[model samples]
Target: MDIKNKVIVITGGGRGLGRAMALELAAKGAQLALADMNREDLDTTIGLCMEQGVIARGYVANVAVEADVEQLFQDVVSDFGALHGLINNAGITRDGLFIKAKDGKVVGKMSLEQWNQVVDVNQTGTFLCTREAACQMIELGNEGCIINISSVSRSGNMGQTNYTATKAAVEAMAVTWAKELARYGIRAASIAPGYIGTEMVMSMKPEALEKIASGIPAKRLGKPEEIARTVSFILENDYVNGRCIEVDGALRI
Candidate 1:
């Protein structure tokens, strides 16, 4: 689709990759409805996008909450009069082994708290947002697309049982949605990113971050803008659907 003037709703658009995509899309003439838990971050993003001469509004929300997700789409429709795209970018990590063992004894394990928290935000949250987006788009007879943010960890990271499951689910779901929602004139796709040089990842100890970078064929981390560019490509290309594109710098992991 021609990106200009399209109304796109991006969850977790306050910072990191979501913010980057919002800024990039805004620059290309898209009106944005950005949702995040942090009002300050949302305000920051809104300010940046507005400076680009685009219509940008910030909605404070938690994607995991069904009520919040419902309100978000309703507000987007009321504000923009149409919904064109949705980026399911809001996610969290609760990394831990499914079962931790010391010596010959199992002294620790992943808590249900950790499991539920990550699943709720990453899995359930994506489901909720996409469902609302589908309903809104179909009811309005709007042709739109959905992007789910997956992770390289979807392949199974050593210490990310909860996160891995959700990421894998994210990648698999786009195919299902694409097949199921094709009749509704909606396309679904996923982007699985490797370690990107984001604020949160860069905050990690240099040694650890470098160790990860060394594993990638690119010999460096990916940039948020790179992922943003992929989003743009997916939007502009009409035939790219029901697929999971890995933006992982050729990293096997």
Candidate 2:
């Protein structure tokens, strides 16, 4: 499970937590295949990883598409010659109440489009990427680790029906994959991150950010590197399988 020289694929590696993870793993001497829809962002991350003296490549793929996910793994293994780890970090959020009513009459509700978009990217994307990555690892006789990026909101956050459902499903999928893939020496796990100081989160109104920090017992937002470090820990510890590591600063939503 040593990360040094291991080849790892990180979906959504163009920015945010995915970028943080790519840097962390690169620092540990891991080869990286970073996938993202933004070619510019992907190139930026690739350059950063390369600066750390590790082999890094960028692939533009939509994790939600079956063909894209399949081709991503194939390309990674072809370039790196082996697949050692996969981090399913590609996800989207379209937060809305499942049902919204006013004065005893329905006003609005989460649209089918919102539900389907999040499900396709967060839940189905994880499934597709993991399946293809596992196939590559098994066929190549490599022991690998798969880490799904879940969320603290998986417990059912207000205004996040679609996101919450997909987050929960990915966590459950990790557990199932751990049990199912053990025979092939591939371990699966998940990390549930709280409100972190990513660019998107930090762009919220100052008051909103303060309110969120006040809710967490830690009295502050999490750093992206904190979750990145947790990823490294799971990949290094062979015994840590089928579990969701919460990096939520003791917050419960």
Candidate 3:
């Protein structure tokens, strides 16, 4: 589908990969409904999109909240009249081993709080947003695309049981949605990024960063725009569906 003049909604569009995708889509003449909980960051993103000369609006939303997700879609439809695409990019991480470790030794079990928080935001949030977007697309009776932001860690990560599970579930939902929504002309796909050098990664210890980078075949981390480019590819390619494109520098985590 041509991105020009298309109405696209991106969850967690205030910063990181979400912000990058928003700018890229806006540059292509897409009308953007950028949603995030951080009002300041959302405003910054809006400014950047406006600099690209696109019509973009920012909405403060917590994707995990069903009411927020529902209202957000309604607001987008009200503003843009129709929704063409959705990028389920909002996610959070609470890293902890299922068996807690201290100094590489087993200490205790992971907290229920940690597990539930990650699952609530990453998995449930994606589901709610996708459901609302699908409803809107079906209502309009037009073909649309939905891209879920997954992670290479979905296969499993040492200290990311909750995070990995949530991402894995996202890919599963993507496949299921693709098959179910196909009749309605709505395609669903996912992008699993490897070690990307976003602010989240930058916050890691220097040695830890080096260790992770060494594992990647590319010998470096990925850029947010690389993921954004993949999103654009999925949006423009009508035949691609029910697949998770791994943008991981050939690294299997």
Q: Which residue window of length 10 is worst by lDDT in model 2?
A: 244-253
Per-residue CA lDDT of model 2 for 36-99, tens digit only, reads 9999999999999999999999999998999999988988988999999999999999988889
Expressed as tens digits, the lDDT of each residue in 1-253 for candidate 1 is 8889999999999999999999999989999999999999999999999999999999999999999999999999999999999999999998878888889899899999999999999999999999999999999999999999999999889889999999999889999999999998899999999989999999999999989999899999999999999999998887889998899899963
**Candidate 2 regions with alpha-carbon error over 4 angstroms:** none
What lDDT does candidate 3 reach at residue 135?
A: 93
TM-scores of all predicted structures? 0.98, 0.99, 0.96
In angstroms, the error of model 2 at 198 is 0.3
Candidates ranked by lDDT, best first? 2, 1, 3
Model 1: worst 10 consecutive residues (lDDT sum)? 244-253
Candidate 2 or 1, higher lDDT = 2
What tens digits encode model 3's per-residue C-alpha lDDT throughout 1-253? 9999999999999999989999899889999999999999999999999999999999999998899999999999988899999999999988876886689988888899999999989999999999999999999886899999999999988889999999999999999999999999999999999989988889999999999889889989999999999999999999999999999998973
Deviation in angstroms for 250 in model 1? 0.3
The best candidate in terms of lDDT: 2
lDDT of 3 at 5: 94
lDDT of 2: 0.96
